[model samples]
Target: MEIEVAIAGGHGKIGLLLGKLLVEQGHTVLGLIRNPDQEDDLHAIGVEPVLCDLEADDDVGEAVAGVDAVVFAAGAGAGSGVERKRTMDLGGAVKLIEAAREKGIGRYVIVSSMGAADPPAEGGDAFGEYLRAKAAADRALVESGLDYTIVRPGMLTDEPPTGRVEIGSRVERAEVPRADVAAVLAAVLVAPNTIGETFELISGETPIGDAVAAL
Candidate 1:
């Protein structure tokens, strides 16, 4: 149970929260961050930070080396344009899959969006394009031949973690806290039954443990 897990966007809202929980559960967490300055933030929570750029670097394999599982939480952000959306959201995920394959790491998890399964039919705006990019990335992971779980959460909020969630193959739009999403991601990472599954999450009655165990 002392496996090592790495989070590609380790400093991100969900990634950082998940890293803390993983460390507390007696797992070693390696957080891949673009800024070396963020090392202190991760170290403060007992996470080992590995500095690497997911979009523009060639060291993804090295960044994720020796980890038992990987969680890709990287994104280009709302202010970013179309190219960045593809380069970071889609391209970043593909690189991680390639690295996981190259390094012999089988377990992979992705922090995706609810609409990723089906991109918007007619729009090229940022949100529309973002969904398209995510859909592409999700497809890549499924075809990567790796043990993967794609957790798509609806409207992200900054509220506190509910420790409960509603999980299904596809769910309606609703808001869930970033903290809850992090907790669910952490749970999904170690749940063997969750492998090869893609689910959507939102606020609900089922506890995190039960939600994932029932996967």
Candidate 2:
């Protein structure tokens, strides 16, 4: 089933890969980008680039308009301060959810961290701060009343696509390549049963298609 999908933060590392894969699969993709300069790259791959800052209140509603599903793939990268993390991670997700609700978007898929189910211990550093922000956003998504899939992934690596993965609810800490993560996102978009479910993803010997099916 071909669906029109909107990908927030689609200019970033994982987003770029997802845009390409979705396009290759014959799905209509709109790549929502905060950086205007990245628009050209996104357009080169058949993704309609819409300039909208999730932290800002403008152009976001129009960006998701007419789309069938939304993937919240945005994040605050390394070296950024905690405020940016909160705004971009948690606040940004909230804004998107609000906008999606207004737009009547039914399916929402969020990319979250593995240990986000539990709050980090005290004295948690920057990484912990990221996790907390994601956890908060995950909780918000659950309560949003939208069809949602929360993916808690372990360590994100830059390895090539392995075509294999491990997925289960309440799984312990594990690592998965970014390519595999993209595959999972694509699968969740098309899988009806994935809606309203949260799963932990990791790299394993199991085939990617089968792993998602088992989820």
| Whole-model lDDT per candidate | 0.92, 0.89
lDDT of 2: 0.89
Candidate 1 residue lDDT tens string, 71-94: 998899989998888999999999
Q: Which candidate should be chosen as best, given lDDT against the real structure?
A: 1
lDDT of 2 by residue, 1-215 (tens): 99999999899888989999999999999998878899899989899998888987643777899899999999888787778778998988988899899999988999998888887864477778888899999999999999999998889999998988888887757778898899989988998878889988889889877877776
Best by TM-score: 1
Which residue window of length 10 is worst by lDDT in model 1? 51-60
Instruction: Give the TM-score (vs. native) of candidate 2.
Output: 0.96
TM-score for every candidate vs. truth? 0.97, 0.96
